[model samples]
Target chain A: MNMLRRHWPWLLVLVILLAFPFLFYDWTKGRHSGFVLTLMSEIGVMAIFALSYNMLMGQAGLLSFGHAVLFGLGAYCAAHVVNMVKAGTIWLPTELIPLAGGLGGLFFGYVFGWLVTKQRATAFAMITMGLGELVSAAALMFMAFFGGEGGITIDRVMDTSLVGVRYTSPWQVYCLVLAWAFIAAALMRLQTQTALGKMANATRDNFERAQFVGYDPRMVRLMQFTLSGFFAGIGGGLYVLIYEIVTFDTVSAAKSANALLAVYIGGAGGFFGPILGTIVVVLLQSGVSLLSNAWLLYVGVLFIVMVMYAPGGLIGLIFMHLPIWRAGRMRELLLPYARAFPPALLVLLGFVFMVELASFTTIGAAQGKRFTIGGQLIDTTAPMPWVIAIAALVLGALWLRHEARGFRQRWDELMEGSKRAQATAAPKPQEAVA
Target chain B: MEVFVVSLLNGLVYGMLLFMLASGLTLILSMMGVLNFAHASAYMLGAYFAYTISQYIGFWPALIIAPVLCGLIGAGIEMWGLRRVHQNGHIAELLFTFGLALLIEKGVQMTWGLLPVPYRVPELLDFPLFKIYGTQFPAYRAFMLLISALMFGAIWLGLTRTRIGLVIQAALTHPDMASALGHNVPRIFTLVFAAGTALAGLAGVIGGNYQVTEPAMAFTMGPIVFVVVVFGGLGSLSGCFIASILMGLIQTFAVVFDVSLADLLAKFGFVVTSSTPFAEILTVTLPRIGALLPFLMMVLILVFRPRGLMGTRDT
Candidate 1:
């Protein structure tokens, strides 16, 4: 009962995730929005990808600029495997395709890890970047495996499912993705409790100390990298199933950047951080991108802001408020938060305004896109909108600065109170255990 | 012989331009321990800024102004952005710069549009400077060479001769002690960063017209510059210069050479065919694999010599 009570939130989240697509269901057509389903499936695949990335950045203290190499190669392997199954050269259940990808990832990860694990920190990052470039270049050059620029295509409905479900529809595919996501996430979570995971943490904090404790730091790194690759490969397998085609772009620096962005923006401090980050990143990519050409600009600014201010990420911010909530002083900061919201919103709107205006002036003009607000078109050539945007940005920034000071003061007070209460409520220590 | 001479000259011009950019990156990275990922973005900005400015005044004034503007922007980023993130650690600082690179790319696209700008060579330098056997070498290439050489000489002199240069060197090796000695390390950091970015901008001013000025120029140039830096080793300007030149020659000559591994192997009585296990490796021409060479060299250099050639310390 206690365990159930403690884990109820996870159950709630799962229910929410399952119910989300139905919100956009078309009853008349008896189907889900292809766009929404695909977007959600993308989120699922990317969530797994980001989590795998965290196994390096968050757990092992390794920053990779080319994680997509593992993901991409695994995808290529899976694509080839599917084609083979279709050709009757190989026999495998549809559900087991991701395992083949995992094996592929493990193979490459082991090979590449041998080269990269010799170095640590900045050198490792540089080497991985070079490796990423080399592989990407090879992907374009070698037409046999990577299928040149046209890429490799496969049919997902191979009719070889162990569970006897032909994965023809997006719904079926999404369900498979969900099941796999859960399995991968749970396995990854359990792995963190293992000795290797703890040792990986130890090395991350202090490699020399870890070495003193009779562990090879390089070995620890290699193991972590290989395991991470396995999970990332599974994500790549799902990608092949959904998209039906895998291209050189899958292995590109930009794809690696996607995983990095998701991990960083979501916060690398906690287990659920990358998942949170993946959702936000995917939404911004799919949703916000449809609304504006300057979506990349917004994502960039957000990333910078998070790095500068909230390096702990969204989860970290939430965790910071935990003590106050426990102390029942969360209500005290409501007023300050309310005061800060308007200015923050104003600043965001103003920034977006300027970006849109600038974008419309160049890219928009070429595309014949006029800037609009609430069904009313705003002239790009006009000085009025520019002045308003500038005014809002400048004024809101100043206002936010003022409100931020108040919020900080209130926060510190509440946090100090929480600490004091917890200290006083605890039993005092005996002098000599008499 | 004509191809050899022309390729050498072209490589020299390209290498010098790379040095102009990579030197600044080398200094900033070594001194600050912050890899300024936006270094190439500054180069792109310099190109776009020069293009716009040239349209109004002329290329000469644009050359003088664009780099200065980039320098000022670099100073602002260091003071406002980098200084604030310095307390967070190197990873945070790196992420900050990475985000800045993305933002700058988007910003450039928004301002300049998606198309390449017509940032042409001035009429004075448009004509042929000399004939190489049968082909005429453009005077603009000669101008690029002259400017890069002058800048290189100036940088070498400044670093070895000037008092500020001595101070910078002291700080680069021992920042905390330099701080304790009351030399204002933060200001020096800002100065170094600005100077480095300005150097990149100068390269952009020359290189943009030499190649093409577009949004994608930064992405294309960014990785190759990094390859040069890594191959040369971190914190070594001379190494950077050498690596740049070597890479420049390799890339230029690789395009000229049509020899494949298969052809070399055939001389030793080894045959590569369609049925071979690694036929792609044997049959691919040097020119076909030109893009892979620099990265291959970087990876090999990193694997064999982590300190890089002439590098005084480990990265």
Candidate 2:
């Protein structure tokens, strides 16, 4: 009962994930939506990748710009292993392909970790970036491992699944991805509670202090980096199975940036932050990208705003209200939040409207796409829409600012009340000592 | 001999262009402790702005106006965006600039579409300036060299000969001390950042027509400029100049020299086959590996000399 209570959220999430594909199922055709499955699988792979990235950025205070090297190498290894299995050179279970990737990632991670972990701070970042560029260039040049520009492709149907699963369908591959994502995330979560994890945090907070306490900060960073690489490689292995191809793009700086975006936007403070971030990022990449060409612009603006206003990310913002919720004063600020919502939405719509207008005039016009609203064709070369967009932006911004002041006041009052209530409710340290 | 002379001249021109971009980035990185990931975006903005302005006015007027416009935008970004994020920490500042880079790239695409602009050299500078063997060097390249040299001389004079330069130098070395000595450090930072971006804008104006003015230009040039700064050692202008010239020369000459490591190895009686490890690396021509050289140099430098060539402080 205790275990059930503690693990209810995970179980509930599993149930939802299992049921999600049925919503898009073509019952008459007896087929699932390929797009949804691919997107979800992408989310799973990217979540593991982002979690590994947080091991460095959040836990160990190491900012790497070349993490994709590990992931890409792992993928290449997995692809080779799949090819080997097909040639009857090795007899490995299909389920264990990701393990081969993990070993590859671990090997390269150790070698690269030794090179980069010598220095901490900015120098480490620069070295990793240089290494990333080198590897990416090599990926294009060398045909043996990276397979040149065409990359390495594999047929995932090796007919060697441990449980007799043929893995012919995207559905099967997605299930495998989900399983691996769960296992990797669980292992990583457990890793955060270990001595190395504690020492990594300690080193991140105060390297000098950690060193004074007889811990080698460099060793801690190297170990964390190597372990993170192991998980990232698993993600890469799953990527190969889903797409059946790994390209230089996997090892590119852009891929590394994707991991960074996931971790930063998710909330690096908590374990589940990267997972949440992966969902948002993948949704934006796959979903919003289909609707608007300015999706990247929106994501960029959101990232900047979050960095400035909410460094702790989406999860951090939720955690901020914990004190108020615990004190039972959360309802007091609800009205203020409601009041602020309209203008905020107005500002968002207005900004998006202007962006869409501009984009339509240039990129859309080139592609022969006309600006439209509710099936009504809007002229891109006209002045009226521009005027409307500008007016809405200005007015909505002003209104939002006005509401923001009220929201701030209420928020402060509730937070102060929460603090006072918590102080009174909890036993005092000084009294306990006496 | 002809190839050597021409490659050297071209390398010199390319090197000067790199210096123009690297100088600003070095100033921002050293003084502010912010890497300014958007530095190359500023260069890209310069190209786009010059292209648009040159469409109405001539290239000469756009050359002057575009950099000033970039300087103004830099000032606005510093005053509003960076200053707000300054309190959060250096990482926040870096992320802000990174986001700004993405925004600027998207904005450029939305406004200009996803095509290279036809920003060209003026008719007056279109003819050949010199002929080496059977090849003609365009007068525009000469003009670029002249402009860069003049700008370089002006920067040297401004930094060494002016009171404001002295103040900036002091602030760069010791911000808190400069503040204690009655200088507004933040204002100086804003000034330096704007000036640095303006320099990058100047490089973009000249290099855009020489190269191609495209959205991806920022991503392509940004890393190479970073390599220059890192290799030269952070905060050292002289080292940056040397690194830039060395990189430019190496790139030019590598293209000229079609030699391979395999050939050298064979001469030493150690012939390599197709199945050898890194066989592609051994047989690859110098020109094919030219793109990897800067990054290779940077990594080597960082590993062997963490402080860079002339770096006084640790990066």
Candidate 3:
């Protein structure tokens, strides 16, 4: 009971993971709901990828712009393995196919890390960017291996199996992905406690001190980079299995940007931050794409806010409130939240209106769709819509600013009162103790 | 011999264009220590702006107007966006620029749609300038070389003979010391950014017609430009020049050569069959890997010499 209490978070996560498929299966009825399963699988895969990225960014303090090379190589390797299996050259379980990608990642990481590890800081970033671009370009030009712009595809329905169980269901694939994700994440966590990982952190904090302590910073970086690449490759392998195709987009700079976004938004400092970030980002991407094309704009704005005001990230912000919450002073701030709601809603509604107007003018116009407002068909060809949007934007900004000031004042007053109450109550308690 | 001569001329022209884009980038990167990810986006904007202006006036007028517009945009971005994020540190600044790049790309697509624009070379430079062993060379390419050379001369003189140029040179080498010496460092940074962006704009104005103006143009050129900047070393104009020329020549010559590793191996009495895994790689010719060579060189240079050839600092 004490052990369970100590590790309740881990136990809770395990239960959640095991119960997810059953819940999903029940929700989807008897029909094979591949979309949700595939999305979940992608989320797990991306989580691993994002965590690998955090190893470099958070642990090693290396900011890479081209981390997709490992992932792409892993995908390509998996594709090749799938082809081989289909050709009856090898008999391996579908669950074990991702290992090929991991090996491929390891091989490339060893080779590339040897070169990239020589440079630190900005130089390292530029070198990785160059290598990433080179590989992606090569993927397009070299048709034999990369299959050109068309990419390479392989049939996943192969009869070759070690356990005599044909991999036909999406659930099986999801289970396999979950298993790998768990293993990869656990190993990565363990790595953080190891000697090399500690040295990597040391190098990140102060290279000169690490060198003085008899550890080569370059070697430490190389080891961490290789391991990160291995995990990234596993993610890529899962991607290929889910899609059954690998393309240049897999290794593009945009994909690297995606990984960066996930890590930053999720909170790079925390181990489980990437998982949170991956889930949020993937959901936003898949969900918001259906409603509007301006989701990226919102993400951009959010990222800027995080960088400027909340550098520790969403989790960090939540953690910052722990002292207040524990002291029971949080209740006093409820009125401020109530006062802030109307203006916040106005700002959100105005922002959404502007985004919708812009999207309507661009993508909607291209699709020949008519704009409608309150059941009245509004002509988008007129400038009235644009004028209204601009007005709303300006008005919304003004309201937001006013409300923000009011919110700050209310918060200060509440905090001051709470502190006074605590101080007065402390004297009474002390007197009683005497 | 004919192919070599043509390729050489073509390579030189392309090299000059690459230099135009890379020089400003090197200056900004070394002096500011911020890898502006939106540099290529500025180039793309220049092309689009030129196309729009050319529609109203002519290509010649648009050429001048486009770069000015780009400079103003750069100045605005620096003043409003970058300066605010500068307090956050290098990574935040980089991320901001990256986000800006993404916005620019999507914005361009939204504005212009997803098709290549009809950006043609000006009528004045439409004809052939010369014949290299019966093969005609475009006059536009000669014009590019002349303009690039003129810009190079201006930069050289500005850096060597002007007072502001000397201040910039000092700042490039020692940013902190220069700032401590009572120079308006922020103003200089903004000027450098605007100037660099203007150069990129000019490159786009001319090179867009030489290449193509499209939504994908930024992405296609962004990496190669970065490679040139890195391979040449940060803050070294001479290194940028040499690397640009080398890359241009390599790319041009690679496309002309069709030999493969397998073919070379056969000459050495090693006959490899097609069934092997290595065979796929071995059979790839030089031309096919042209796009990847610059990046390969960049990686190699970074590994062996992070400071680059003629770079003052490690980056």
Candidate 1 scores a chain A TM-score of 0.97
CA deviation > 4 Å runs, candidate 2: A428-434
Interface DockQ of each model = 0.88, 0.86, 0.52
Off by over 4 Å in 1: A1-7, A427-434
Instruction: Return the lDDT, model 1, position A11.
Output: 72
Recovered share of real interface contacts in candidate 1: 0.84
Best by DockQ: 1
What lDDT score goes with residue B188 in model 2? 88
Q: Cα lDDT for residue A283, model 2?
A: 98
| Native-to-model Cα distance after best TM-score fit, residue A325 in candidate 3, in Å | 2.6
Give residue B109's error in model 2 in angstroms.
Answer: 0.9
DockQ-derived CAPRI band for the predicted complex in model 1: high
Model with the higher TM-score, candidate 2 or 3: 2
Lowest lDDT block of 10, candidate 2 chain A: A425-434
For model 3 chain A, give the 10-residue run with minimal summed lDDT: A425-434
Question: Would candidate 2 be rated incorrect, acceptable, medium or high by CAPRI criteria?
Answer: high
After superposition, candidate 3 runs with Cα above 4 Å error:
A17-29, A79-92, A140-166, A294-298, A341-345, A367-378, A408-434, B266-277
